[model samples]
Target: MKHLSRLNKYFLKYKWWIIPGSIFVVISNIFGVVPAQVIGYAVDLITENVHVYNLFSGFNRQEIVYDIFSSNLLYFGLLVVLLYILRGLFLFFMRQTIILMSRHIEFDMKNDIYQHYQKLSLGFYRRNNTGDLMNRATEDVNRVRMYVGPAIMYTINTFVLSVLIIWSMFDVNSKLAIYCLLPLPFLVIIIYYVNTLIFKKSGKIQERLSDLSSFVQERFSGIRIIKSYVREDYTRNMFEIQSNEYKKDSMSLVKVSALFYPTMLLLIGLSTILTIYIGGMQVINGNITAGNIAEFIIYITQLTFPVTMLGWVTSLVQRAAASQKRINEFLDIPPDIQSKSNDETEINGHIRFENVSFTYPDTGIQALKNVSFEIKSGEFVAIIGKTGSGKSTMANLMMRMYDVEQGQITVDGQPIKALNLKNYRGQIGFVPQEVFLFSDTIKNNIAFGLDQVTDDEVFDAAKNASVYHNIIDFDEKFETMLGERGITLSGGQKQRVSIARALIKSPKILIFDDCLSAVDTKTEEDILQNLGKIMQGRITILIAHRISTIKNADKILVLDDGKIIEQGTHNELLSLNGAYTDLYNNQLLEEETKGI
Candidate 1:
């Protein structure tokens, strides 16, 4: 119950349905016992040809009023039919209202989880697998719904039915009731044991499902690599191994679940045996009529079903609790990065990283150490660094993907944290080294960031990125749908399309983090030529390894071993004849040799 309280807000939202549904559950059970009592009286009237009033008096009263219903089979039949009609009506309301509420709650919970996932920082995704998250969002949500819906409905039904039947049993014969109910405590002990096993097994089952889903997601996403490496058989065999493990765990859970029905039935059988034996003895001793014994037997049978349903309901509660725990773990995760203030301010793209030092979480190596730089508006600054020299880390920090551990990052003199994160990120256009495209049309991918973009604007951006010709060559042109991550396109084509995506945003700041690596040198130069014209007054930060790429920038900063070793224009760096000079000479020699 405590575990499920997290969803109280949703429950309260639909309490009108739940309250009325619960009333129907009680009402249905109250009238459901009528047919059994009526049958007992019918048997008594047939045996002695007595009036209904005589049977009601148990043939032990001195004064009995005869009525028109004497030996009346038709009247008893009509009464039983009316009682069942009422019971069926209440049953319909109970199932329709309560069960439907669960679906609504499930819908609400799934959206809530998805909305939360959208707000989580990038670092949270880095630590969790897609499959595990998907399972929590889908399967675990359904399990929790079972707890709030059918489990709750059945529990109420079982209580109401049990109370009604037990009272009738006591009215028939209190001694028989005592004997028949002796096994109930033992049933509780068994249910407790089953609940423990189910809780443990259900957790394992959900984990195995996540593993299987992860395996499938990875295989499908990397199908090209799998075929290129010729590891189809290996991948298939591994899938089978994972699938088999999931099957085994599921069967084990099923085996534990399978015990509940039989355990409840065993207790029910014992109770029934006690009822018959004691009930028959009471009748033989002339303590009660045969009708009383018949009614007692009917009440025991009625109690058997509700008692038996207890096992299933208990299992549902346990499984839901396990799922709730997994979901709560996700819901409880605090976002590592969030906007402290919602205040929005106009940004001029005047960025500064003042003595910023950052080490990645759980890593001993520092990604950035005392890094410091500034870029005024409209400056075409290029950052040159070898791999792992913190070039991308610098970009990530600028975008606020992760905050600095020391010092401050500011935009237009306002601390980055003080500005709203969404508004801050909206002003920057970033093209990362690894480009990702959705499985959608080319036009949609290009215009993804902007809420509204005209076809002319998309075409202009694509033309600027030098991808317009290639897109027109395709049969569907810009409407061509791509495969996962744009697998159908060439590497250079994908990079150009990604550039177009960033370009279409028309942002105040543009970042190209080694984005032109896959394109040929001539094409890269042409794209940069177009970009230079479009970036007249916008702050542009270009991260590249090839010296030729950033040779004509307004300023160049050389980073090595997490520090700024040199900063100058290309001509000034060449005149200094330092690290930048060495890199330029090596690249020049390689090109000259290639020409030969």
Candidate 2:
């Protein structure tokens, strides 16, 4: 219910529909009672020996009674039909309105969540699972939609109809009405307890469902690894365990729900029996008329429906509340990064790091410490390091993936933090180690960001990356679909396509984060040579492990444990005979043995 309160703002926007929907429901309930009243009157007339015909005869007692019965019965039947039709019409429109509103709200919620994810630091994604976020955006939103639609309307229907029936009963005979209501308080108590239990259990069920979805998603995404290691049987067993847990939780919920209808029936049965017993005695003792007793019985039967509906609506509301809580939890997490300025500034590609240091948010272990460097405009620099060194962190810092805690990083002598994020990001192009390509034509992937990139521009960039010939070899050429994440392409081809994407941006500063790892040495050399020719006046930062990749750079750095251990030209570092020199010697000897 508290979760539902948050929906008040959205509900307010659609109140124009909701208000009329409620009015129609009230009218339907009011007309719904008429048939019962008509039945009571007819029964009383028959018991009093009234004629079924001759209602048009002049001024006779029996004729008057017949007229009353005939006219009232006709009107009551017509009212019933009319209200039922109105109820259906209004309910259809109401559902449409509410569902439309829910969809809009869901859209807004998902967009906000996605936008928040974009603003968050990389560390946030490292700590969360992709499947859980997808579940929240998809399944949780659908649950909210159900609540706003049927759950809301049915709840209103139950309350309004129950009140109308009860008040009608009292109008007929207060004593009989009280006896009929004897079971109500207990029914309310049971519903209250059931709602509480449903909320707690449904929350657990949703969590297990999320875990199951995550398990399945993770396994499917890594199916290649599973097959490579011949772990299919093990993966199947793990999936079975997760599925069984989800099944057990769902069955428990079913068990709880199964009890609700029967308990409602029991209470309804008891209330009806008591109404007959007491009202029949009152009629026989002349304390009330036969019509009153008949009306009381009709009202008693009507009471059961709303009571049963109460249970149904209560269960739905509890499930919706549980879902709302999960959704709100995701929405409540503050982004780890926030853009502070919106003033756009032009970039000149001069980068400086002054005594900078940083640690990953969760681990608290320093990834980079007191590292400082400067790269002037148009310089080609390479960072070389062994695994576990701070090479990648330096590249990430340049892209502002995670901001440094100590000191400042400036581009063109202006602190990056002071510049607008969108403007700053536009000046740099990055090609990461992992290549991700959407399932689209090659041309679209290359021209993803630019509004109007000509085919010639795309082909020229691809030619520079040495992938244009391969693209033209395909049956569909540039229009060929790449399949999921470019699965159709070889690793080197995928890397080349990613490289072409970055090149198409024509950014002032280009970053290749171990981008050449997959390509052959010859292909890598050619691409580097072409890049060097075309990017003479642009800053280029290359992160690599191979000596061949960094040998031609103007300056090279050897990093270890978040600090620069050595920095110089390739020949100068080899002369030092340190970590870099040792690595170069091993690689040179290995290549010689292979007769390269």
Candidate 3:
């Protein structure tokens, strides 16, 4: 019922089609009853020796049996043909209408889920698998559409046809109808038990299927790495295990499905036998006419069909219910981060961290503790740290990926939480160590996230990042498609394209998080020099391991184990002779040795 309610709005939206569609189904079913009654009337006419024709005149006792048989046969044949045509027409329109409605509903639901996913916090994706999310948005949604499209209509048809058949049977012979319906209570009980089992097993089956999909997707995406390490056999074995488990679970569902129809048929067969024997006796005793007996048989057979359909419909409903529960569970998860304000505010890019502390949710270990920093607008700052030094955490916080537990981060004197999150993020641009580019044209990748930036502006941004020449050199120029993750481009080229993407945003605060590590030292130096000149009046924060990368910064902060161990300009930090000096000296010695 809840699943049906979930689809109510969509049904209502297309009610103009559905209402007529349902009416047609009813009309078709009603006409569908005519043949059985006609058969009964024909049998009665023959038994009574009544004339079927004198060319549409009233009953004539003088007419021959052949004339009666021929005339009634012709009438019955015509009636059957006309009714069948009407049934086909109704079925055609009904299917078309429901299919159209289901498609629209599925599309809208998928779009809504995708939009909601976009608004969800980064932690959601961090905890969920890409394949599982894909299944939810794709396979699960299609399941719902299947139910809405055919399962729902069939269920409704089964119900309506059952009621009409039973009612007509009662009118024909109440005692025989009661006899035929004796097994219904027991049938319902069995169906209820089977439905419960189906729902539970179907849920597990879907979850296992999701896991299987995830394994395959992960292995395919990392096939190169597996081959490089000669782990093909290992990967294949793992995939085989997952695939076998999926097959087992699916067969488990099939076991339940296979039993359902047979059990229904058993019950229906019992009801049919009871009706025939008892109704046959009544006809022999002259308590009911041969026509009524014929009509009762037809109704009994029709009753069994609905019972059979009910069992199948129950299975479909259970499957849909299980899928709905999974989808609802995903939809119910609230985002970890919530924005406190909706209004967009102008940012001057003055960032401040006052005694901030943070612990990752899954791992209770503190990633940052008592960290404090202040950077005025238009200052070029560099953060230098060894691995696991909380440098990335700082950048993540500025982007509001994870919220601070005990302290506040402010931009231009306003608490970041109190500003519109989208606007706040729009003012900052990031280039990470591992660049990600879509399998799209170079121009589109560079101009990503910009609503309407001019082509010339895009070219200029590419030129600033030292990637314009390479793009133009390609046969397709800016229109060249970069394969998955920009795999077609070299690591340095991918990084430069990422840099170009960030530069085109023209954000107030630019963060380059170890983005130049893959490039040659001379190219890195030139890129940094150009970026420094371009960011003269903006807040630029560089995270790097190389001393040359931070030597000209207005300020440099050295982080160790989530704490700032030192802070000063290049000469001042070198004079202090702490962690910064140790790193610089090590690098300087390595360079001299290479020179030697």
Candidate 4:
């Protein structure tokens, strides 16, 4: 229950529903416990000629009624029927309110977790798997909702009914009540141990479920690779192994749960048997009336349901607590990056990195070391390097995906940190080396970030990216739906659409992160030619492996081993005959050899 404290805020939000619902639960259970007393009084009316007035006065005085089918008997029977009707009504309203409140809370929790995931930094996603996070948001949230709904309703019903029924039994015969309830303390002790085991087992079950989910998600996502390499049997065997682990954990929980119900029933059955034997002995001795013994047995029978349900209710509570703990861990993690600044100034895209250095978290290798560069507004800068040479690292810092550790990056003479991240990133358009598109229409994918993009804007951007003709060739054209990650499109087509998506933003700064690698040389040349016109009066940074891609830029930077090895115009670097020259000569030789 203490683990449920995190939901206090939501409970407060929904108090209007919960408070009345709880009252109804009490009312319903109170009504549900009244039948035992009614039956006892009716028996007294028949056997001992005890009238209703004598029963309420707590006496066994004999008073004969003149008529057997009197108005009083009819009225008492009607009252019992009305009590049951009220019980049903109150139970209905209680379910309507509390159960619906649980659903609403589940909805809010799912939304909150999704929004929190959106706000979390890239590093958090890197640390956690998709299936684990998905399970926490969905399966774990549902488990918590069970605690707030059925578990709460049953627990309250158990307590209230237990109290009312036990009170009625004490009124009938205190000695009988004592003998019946003496075994209840041991039931509590049993529940205490059983619930602890349930909590432990439930956590393990959820964890194994998450592991199985992750395994399934990964295997499905990579099914193409599995089939391509003829590893279907291998993947299936791996899946079976994970499924068995989940099954073992589930069976362990089942074993613990299986013991709980029978144990509770045995204790409850023992108490009931003891009550009957003692009350019968008392009746034989004339210490208590037959009506009193009848009423005591009825109350104990009424108590049996709530007592037996104790084990199940405890399981729900313990399971919910375990799930809540998992969910709270996610909610408790502080994001590694946040936009704390309130500045709203528009950016002019004069970017500079001064003595910048960065190391990825949990990795000892430094990605960039004292690397620095400057690009004024309207300048075209190109970065050329081998793979893992900090080319993409610079672009990431520019986007503030990860902030620099040693030095500062500034835009328009303002520190990048001082600018709100959302606003800052909004002004720059980026196309990564590996393009990703949503499973949506081509037009929507192209105009992804921008709202209310017109047909002209979409067509013009597509043309500028040299992909408009390819789009129009399709029957549905821009309206054609794509498969996941645009798998229906060719590699070159995907890159072109990605470029068009970026171009549609009409940003003041554009970054091409080796975006042309998939396109043919002729199409690449045409795209760059159009990009030159679009790059006018806007900062452009090109990151590429091809020497031909960056040769015409106003400035070219060559990097190696996380350090900038050379910086000059293409002709100047060619004259220097250093790292840049070596890369150019090797590429030119490859082209010549291929021509042969």
For model 4, the superposed segments whose C-alpha errors exceed 4 Å read 49-67, 70-75
Q: lDDT tens string, model 4, 260-287? A: 8888888878887898899899888888
Q: In model 1, which residue pairs have backbone atoms overlapping below 3 Å?
A: none
Candidate 1, run of 10 with poorest lDDT: 62-71
Per lDDT, the best of the predicted structures is: 1
C-alpha TM-score for every candidate = 0.94, 0.92, 0.94, 0.95
Per-residue error (Å), model 3, residue 73: 2.6
Better of 1 and 4 by TM-score: 4
Instruction: For residues 1-596, write the lDDT of model 3, one tens digit per residue.
Output: 57546767778887886787677668767776777787788678766654334443543544565566778778877887887788778777777777777788899889978987887887788778988988888888887887887787787778778878888888887888899888889888888989899888888888988998888889887878999999999988998998898898889888987987888788778887887799889989988887877777787777777787787788778888888778887888887777878887778899999999988886677878899999999999999999888998899998898999988998888887888888888888899877999999999999996989889989998999998998899999999998888988999999999999999988899999999888888888878888888887899999998988889999999999999999999999989988999999999999999999
TM-score of 4: 0.95
Question: lDDT scores for all predictions?
Answer: 0.89, 0.83, 0.85, 0.88
Q: What is the lDDT of residue 180 in candidate 2?
A: 84
Return the lDDT, model 1, position 536.
86
> What CA RMSD would candidate 3 show?
2.9
> Which portions of model 1 show Cα errors greater than 4 Å?
50-71
Of the two candidates 3 and 4, the one with more favorable lDDT, higher being better, is: 4
